[model samples]
Target: RHQGFFRLDPHVDPISDGGNVFILGFCSPTVMSLTPVGGAMGSLMNQRAVSTKSWAAKEDIDVLMEPRTLCHLHGDARQLLNHGIRMGVDAAQLKKQGVNVPDNASLYDWWGGMTSPVQRSPMRLSVVLAFADVDEIF
Candidate 1:
């Protein structure tokens, strides 16, 4: 479980790790956005060179990850793109903007889908699993 605002900058796995990473959303239904900056070209500098082209052509490639969603990042997607959750304002600000910030009971129902509500906290959890090749490690 994790809480608070964060932005993971664009990066590739230095250890290689089979050039793959998986993220499974467990709770909270907020949208996760991914932007593919460019095709993997071995280094960040090379990736940036093509970023303009990628951004111009990125309209159809942006992804919105939903709750219970499983996302796979590999190859160029893993090495040349950036993904992050939107940082929402405080509850009061949200309410002022006409967003219904869920109360504990509502949040409990939203997460658990149970008639009996349980205490809820501002926690969002996602499990990340990375895989690597044995030969690469050895």
Candidate 2:
């Protein structure tokens, strides 16, 4: 069912496995929670790239970056172009019902990608980004 969702290529460099992080937060369904913890986590992950001395001996740096790079290969390269198309169409449909998204705010990419299907493809991440606003929420 996940077919045609993503592609994997290994020629890319800076691959790492690091880890697959998933976060789920519970809310009252009325109030939106925008926390700094997310940003702090991102910063820590980025630091892993520079902290070559630590975690280096435990894991290969190249292997650590794999999941991130592969995720990007899945579709991030085309995100900046395709994201708005999907968002705009939905927004237009909503506007017809008097629900219009803010002009300064728009849907943004959070994360979406397919894992490498090939058995030999190295572990890596394709890409990662953070987005804010109502468009992204809905």
Candidate 3:
């Protein structure tokens, strides 16, 4: 079991284990209990490329996954993309901070029964394991 929020800054994980990281979300009926209410909702992925000596996000590759899902990143996807959790900000809050939000923008209009602002979740329990792929090691 893990405690507190999981707001990670986007970057390539150290991968010192020479293995991929696996994430599982345990959020369910209490999903709304996420810190910031709707903030920290899901996970985000962005394409990354080398810019001289540093890596930077390339445009047009943004993606977000809803809460309590399973995902694995391997090979190029693991090494060449920056990943992190999404931070949710209420339109009201944004307005209070002087950012413009259309008064009519209610936002949560998913077609089906699912609704979440992309890759986001406030907290989760993570178990890390390492194993060198035999093919990669051989």
Candidate 4:
């Protein structure tokens, strides 16, 4: 994902949010700056961001997941929050943009340890599973 790229699922209905979402991360050659910025908070500040039309009293992100992580969001987490990569997430660009290094960008310190090929590479690999039905499991 790029520094400017981001997404928020705006689904809010009973048993909606596509039932549930599971993200399995992967990378044959992992890069420190390629982790996804997830927003799994049930609400913003104090208000809930359930429906697409519902505006929150405060629009603050609540959580961030690590690289090579398995994230599962269901119930209120899936229905009431907009969970996914947030904007300005690129670690390199963050320095140029003068944005403070986000707390989740822990890999920045490990940049010196990356292998030569992986150091120059920028990639995001992960399998995202959405629960459709029990039959889908088979």
Candidate 5:
């Protein structure tokens, strides 16, 4: 599984001034399902409360983060979206939830659509490289 975090803002964090920031995420080959569990601490426009939200909550994009795929986030996307790979869903649990599981597909495959039960790969290993613009490093 893969997860990304964005912690900035000068008032909250002394190490950051919340300036220009970017994140480069590198996914390994073992990644099969890239489920986004979004819940960032921020207030949306017209929204009264600061609730957990994410871009995936609004979009229905099916593009999985395949092996060797590079994910880039900057500015608004970096600060707003909170992405993470979801835990494996058990077969029985899916059925109990009234989810339709295909005969030939496993619970993970039914949700992720990348791998089958037997063909399921290992946990994903990812590396995050962060960059911040600054005049001096003190």
Candidate 6:
């Protein structure tokens, strides 16, 4: 599974920001499914699996730095914070632009289609959405 996050306006209440963040992540891959079809009426029945890594609060992410399962960091807190926040924002923006979807079908059918692909591809299992406002499990 792929993981990601976003940095919201701290001014937004924590719960509301967190909820929107979660929706933003959940709605992301849904929007991706809207892709391949150009938002038409097809489905991603042909694709494979879809999985996402969990969301982590800024503090939690900081703690993960000790082991650093994710590579490519320069070991700077401000940089990491900036990167994570931007990732969340970019995930949101990507949804707006249309990317990372299996097909252009309804959410249920799209999910159903993803659950059962015509030709299984390990690549599909790697697909995931990320955002900062997102909460754990989103």
Error of 4 at 83 (Å): 1.9
The models' CA-based lDDT, in order, is 0.45, 0.21, 0.37, 0.38, 0.34, 0.23
Please provide TM-scores, in order, for all candidate models, with all chains considered together: 0.49, 0.15, 0.47, 0.41, 0.42, 0.16
Which ten-residue region of model 5 has the weakest summed lDDT? 4-13
Residue 114's lDDT within candidate 2 is 11
Q: Give the alpha carbon lDDT tens digit for every residue of 1-138 in model 2.
A: 021112221112222322222222121011111211112222233332212122122221121122223222222222211111010112333344465343332221111111111111212122343333344356
* Tens digit of per-residue lDDT, candidate 1, span 54-84: 2223331434345677889876677666654
Segments of candidate 2 deviating more than 4 angstroms: 1-90, 108-138
What does candidate 6's lDDT look like per residue over 79-100, in tens digits?
A: 2232221112223222444545
Q: How many residue pairs in model 4 have overlapping backbones?
A: 0
Candidate 6 Cα deviation (angstroms), residue 77:
10
lDDT of 3 at 126: 48
Worst 10-residue lDDT window, candidate 1: 108-117
Per-model RMSD to reference: 9.9, 20.6, 10.9, 10.8, 9.2, 16.8
Question: Model 4, 24-58: lDDT tens per residue?
Answer: 65542232222112433433422221221122223
What's the distance in Å from true for residue 20, model 3? Answer: 2.6
Candidates sorted on TM-score, descending: 1, 3, 5, 4, 6, 2
How well does model 6 score by local distance difference test? 0.23
Candidate 4 has what TM-score?
A: 0.41
TM-score of 5: 0.42
What is the model-wide C-alpha lDDT for candidate 5? 0.34
Model 1, CA-based lDDT: 0.45
